[model samples]
Every structure is written in structure tokens, then in C-alpha cells.
Target: MSGSREEQLAAWTAKTKRVGFRQRNWSVVRWLAALTVTLLLAGLAVSLLDYPPALAAACWVAAAVTGAIMLIWFFDPRRFRARPSGIS
Candidate 1:
């Protein structure tokens, strides 16, 4: 309420960019952990249940592919493009 709208927008944009940068830097570690968990869960499910081998393999492949795509998106700088700072 204090600053002009443009000033406020710029401030918010800067803060978001900073946070995004930090996340990007740590994304590799996060992605690894996520993949590890996903694989472990899939393995556990397959082992504990009576799922068909083919079905279990398919599900594991699908989950792995989806996670990989998401990981790529998460670390992609282009995907996190900040709004133009010309709001004034």
C-alpha cells in the first residue's frame, strides 16, 4: 500500500526471482531424492502386491518418465522466466 504499484511489482518480482534461483540451484538434489523415493515405492508395491510383471514394469516406466520430465521442467531457467519489469 505504501509504494507505487510499479515499485511493488518490481520488488515482488525480484524476490520471486531470488527464491527461484535458490530452488534451481538445489533442484538436482531434490530430483535425485524424488527419483529414489519413486523407485523405492514402485519396488515395494510390486513386491508386496500381486501385480502382473508387465503391468508393474509399465507403471514403473511411466512414473520414471513423468518424474524425469518434471525434473527437467523444474530446473529449466526458461520455464521460470520472470514477468517483464516494466509494470509502471
Candidate 2:
């Protein structure tokens, strides 16, 4: 069911407060997940050598992509924007 405008705004405000408090924390979770997947794929690639080279190549490529994402998430400039103290 659709909620009223006031109710919706209140809910949004509460969620924003929670999200702001938890900011940058979930970045750790993403980095961990990326590293885990990359390591697993790298191991598989080593084990699969001389077999399906294409599959290993694909896994290595996926690892590289995720590695780039992890780096970007850790070093992104947009993540550090300063909030204005006064409302315009």
C-alpha cells in the first residue's frame, strides 16, 4: 500500500540518518567480497592450467574487473564530499 507524503518523508529521513552513520563501513564488506572472489578464481585458474584455457582466462578477467572495483571503491574521490553546514 502507498503511504502518505508526510509518512514517506519521515521514513526517508530516518533511513538517511541510519545510512549516513553506516557510511564507508559497507565498503569493507565489498572489498572483502571482491578479494575473496579474486583469490578463488586465481586458484581455479592455476588448477585448470593446460585444460580449458578460455575458462581460466575468463576467470582471470573477472578477477581483474573486481580488483579494479575494489580499488575504485577504496580510492573514489566522490566518496569524500563535504556536506554543507547551512541549507540554502
Candidate 3:
């Protein structure tokens, strides 16, 4: 509780990142699953509300693309590593 702000932040970041592989994988799975369900619900709601076909399809495509990007980004190994030098 007495460290400089940068020291405190580094300690916190290290602590948060100290999970085992299994735990990290589970966390990723849960995150993606929740996003999938939310997107599904939104898509369904849009369709039920009788939005124009193009609009509804666009919404679904956007949601799907966003989710795909997130999934890929989440599993990017570089993100699990420590920050590079000069990066605060």
C-alpha cells in the first residue's frame, strides 16, 4: 500500500495475470459464451421486431464479425505476455 503509483500498477497487473493456463482458458470461454448468447438474443429481437431484412441481416453480420474479432484477439498469445519496454 505504500509503493509509487507505477509500482502499484505493475504489481496489480502481475497479480491479475498470474492465473494458470486452465483458469485462463476457462475465463476466455465464459467471456465468449456470454457474448455469443447476447448477440443471439439481439439478433432474434431484431428479427422479431420486423426490421427490414437488410437491416436485420446487417445487424447480425456486424455482431458476428465483432464477435469473431474479439475471439481471435482474446486468444492472441502476445496479450498474455508482459508489456514491452516504454509502454508505461
Q: Top model by TM-score, which number? A: 3
Report lDDT (Cα) of residue 13, candidate 3.
74
Looking at model 2, report the run of 10 residues with the lowest lDDT sum: 79-88
Question: What's the TM-score of each model vs. the native?
Answer: 0.43, 0.43, 0.47
Of 2 and 3, the candidate ahead on TM-score is 3
Error of 1 at 22 (Å): 8.8
How well is each residue in 37-83 modelled by candidate 3, as lDDT tens digits?
67767777889999777776776776787678667767877546443
Model 3 weakest 10-residue run by lDDT: 17-26
Q: Report the Cα lDDT for candidate 1.
A: 0.68
- Write the residue-wise lDDT of candidate 2 on 1-88 in tens digits: 3799999988888877656532354556487676759766675967567667676766667777767777776676556544444522
Candidate 1 lDDT at 41 equals 82
lDDT of 2 at 73: 69
TM-score of model 3 (CA atoms): 0.47
Cα RMSD (angstroms) for every candidate in the order listed: 9.0, 8.5, 9.1
In candidate 3 the C-alpha lDDT for residue 15 amounts to 72
Stretches of candidate 1 off by over 4 Å are: 1-43, 81-88
> Clashes in candidate 1: how many?
0
